[model samples]
Target: MKAWFKSGAPWVWLNGGAVALCMIMVVGLLGLIAVRGFGHFWPADLVQMSVLDRDGDRQEVLGELVRKEVIPARVARTNGYTVAEDVPLVTRYLIKQGNRDLGSDFQWYLDVGMGEWHYPENAIVVERREWGNFYGFPVALKEHGEVISRLGDEDFWPEVEARVERSVDLHNEIRRKEKVEIGSINHKLERLRLERRRLELQGVSPEEMAQAEEQFAVEREALNEEYRRIKAERDAIYEQIERDSFDVETVNGMEKTIHLHNIVRVTRSNHLGVFGKLAHYMDRFWEFLTEEPREANTEGGIFPAIFGTVTMVIVMSIMVTPLGVLAAIYLREYARQGTVLKLIRISVYNLAGVPSIVYGVFGLGFFVYFLGGSIDELFFPASLPAPTFGTPGLFWASLTLALLTLPVVIVSTEEGLARIPSTIRQGSLALGATKSETLWKVVVPLATPGMMTGLILAIARAAGEVAPLMLVGVVKLAPSLPIDGNYPYIHLDQKIMHLGFHIYDVGFQSPNVEAARPLVYATALTLVLLIIILNLTAIKIRNTLREKYRSASD
Candidate 1:
């Protein structure tokens, strides 16, 4: 037994080490992502705070904060948080008591105004003067604990709801006034039109007729002026409605209303009381990769990134498959061993070695600048100096990646074609099968698994690529979605968001670096998971093909 073990020991050791290394790498990546990215979904206790200004224009505040000791089973009547049901079992278990909707749970803000620093330990905020805050207008809260639990009470939330409703009523009143003014303007304009008709038919002297026409024009101008004012007034009222809402919290079982503007700092779960902090971590783990992109930070959803990556892959596959297969067929079957074939092989091999960034530069110059510039000049003359094709976008970026990965597809297909036993082709020819049919029916099927393997590698590499995409398609912030309602509707030229780019933007471009670091890790984890999903899909295809063709290949 020892002798037999020794004989197979080298192979066992090599395989075991490889497996261990792969496991370690995967575990380390997931751990980092869990700690940083998904970990942010938990709730923290609200810290009642107060601020004092040197001038003291507005002062004095008192309120009692009320909260629940245990989270209710059905706190929300509507849909709860967007946690995926498909995540690891452990993640599901941890999130049982976590925040149902993370967005409404956690709260943080900052204040740096003129005065000696007055950082009160825990102060109940009774009323807010304005909606502005250090954490911007919006904030998040946790599901459980005193603050969020108390939020469920009708008495606790009635004032905030009332304020919002009052603001809305004010806006509606302003709109009603504007509508009346507009109606008056329209009536006057209609009367002027009738007067103009009468003047035209009266056969008055030309000079008098012209003067009356001028008076009518003056009335029309007055109508336009009044309408503009009405619109402006409506807009102002709408803005007022948006400025009235804010977040509330309970600290030490006391209800405290922190005015948005008075908020001075934002701390993570560390400052949240024990259970509140635990809930935060639990939510982070539970959310994992399942939440829709819409639920992400103000930066935007991960959906766009997911869509862009998948769309690019599908487009690249559609484009490269035919070209690659054709090139492979010619090289393996039609082309004889000669200088041309040898040169072609060398070029294909060399193309694979070129850096991906170079392809991006080439794509930007040729597809974007040259071809796209020409198209823009002919069709989109109205939107000048901003050529659609000349700018970086998904269409051009996908094309660039397709070019970069083309060699891999061709090489794989050629290898697959080469592996077909000559006897099969000979037998097909002997049985009156033409070369085309022989290649299609006999060779292609057997080679599918290998070709699929190549495609998988290409997708894995392309999905993770960021540097090349940066030059051609990625944008820091996209106000409108990539696909929008506009002329030539597809809008392939529009820049899109991506997870990799999101990581870069948050990590490097953010004004609050310390606050954004965790976000960067979360984005990175999302990108990594996206790439893994793509690879897994490709692997599934490869497996299916392998199963289908196993008997034939054997």
Candidate 2:
């Protein structure tokens, strides 16, 4: 054993075991996230069970079994529940009885009191636009105050499905007209107003001002006409959606009228076969990826967040790559090897260790308040008080992140430059190549792959950053995406949604904790996947560069 230790076999085994353990942990965590996140989209069979309270009153519970908890008997007793002293542990169930409109939310029941469980084939889960989900059974469908169809009728299910699909299409149409087309008109009108204000502030001649006003009036009148037409079209679709309604009966026997317009999905969990459930899951997962957030971001899709995150990272990469590469080149290739260089490198390294929130503070103060405010005062005086570029926004957020990740890029690139064999440079110079030619053509190309390594790290860090982003531009909910139909298309001045902040908001700031839990997992998984995709793309490019420059490595 002593000889084995001296031979370093034990140390090698220890290191190998440590690495294996880490890999296992990482894979296990990713697997857990996948199951918890994707499983939320599946249409779980709703269960009906009898639950008894401390008052000895039994109630019929119906909804999806969301969670189960096992607690020590003393803990349960402390929560004001009466249990036998002999029982050391108490099990409880949390049912998502999500009839929020009916003054119902998720409810917990003691496991000791639960009697019989049932999964009714007729029970349906109604995903709604407002007030959360509705767990009940459809009894009848109504149209314009008339009973169009009754449940159990042969055509009822088919009719309901058809109408729901119609509602969805109509809803999308109305939203596009209102939020997209109409919104574009509104944006144009605002820009016109700002332009006129700028002219007034500029002290333009009366004739010139009058000419500008005439042009503005023509454009404004055209926009208004289009807006009116689109608004009318949207209202007509809205009316169609409101025309259909359904009567639902809850487990407690109370009847409620739910308008078809208010619902997003209707799923018959128990009756759905494997194929049906898979289709439903695909539909739900697609919606989660493509739709805008609703219900304080606890429900609906996070398309906006995804778009904003990708856009910001791209913008940050654009800003940082040149800056980081230039700095690294100067430091590594041109700078004198002196104490000053050593201190500069140390400062760059220390910058990476600074608390991320501190960068947020610096960004807010220097970038937003100082630089942005100056830009607004100099070029956008007419939009001054309103701030324009003076506010925290996408541009400032990206710039802030670029600053935060600058060190990673510099260090990685500098190392890459150092790895170039001195013999390569000597040969280039000996072959009558100029110093600049040797450095740029021979050294830089070889270092491209290493620079990409830095970029991957920078992109990964920038994408997940929330603290600095929140101070600079990220919002709990952005009213509009940074990119739109407006000229200059990508609005750097606009606020944006980020997946990291979305996770934090849904997990901690949401009003409904239970609802937020599943969403948190889903958003987290999305962020992880996004990072993986971005890193893979960078890695692919790096590998390609390495292949092209294989002689450098050799």
Best by TM-score: 2
Candidate 2, residues 391-492: lDDT per residue as tens digits?
A: 999999999999999999999999999999999999999999999999888899999988999999999999999999989999999988999888989899
Q: Candidate 1 on 172-216: residue-level lDDT in tens? A: 466466545665566577557756755665678999988997887
User: In candidate 1, which residue ranges exceed 4 Å CA deviation?
Assistant: 1-8, 46-154, 158-240, 246-300, 378-385, 485-489, 549-554
Pick the lDDT winner.
2
Instruction: Look at candidate 1 and tell me the lDDT of residue 213.
Output: 77
Residue 407 CA displacement from its true place in model 1, Å: 1.7
TM-score of each: 0.62, 0.97
Residue 209 lDDT in model 1?
88
| RMSD of each candidate relative to the true structure | 15.0, 1.6
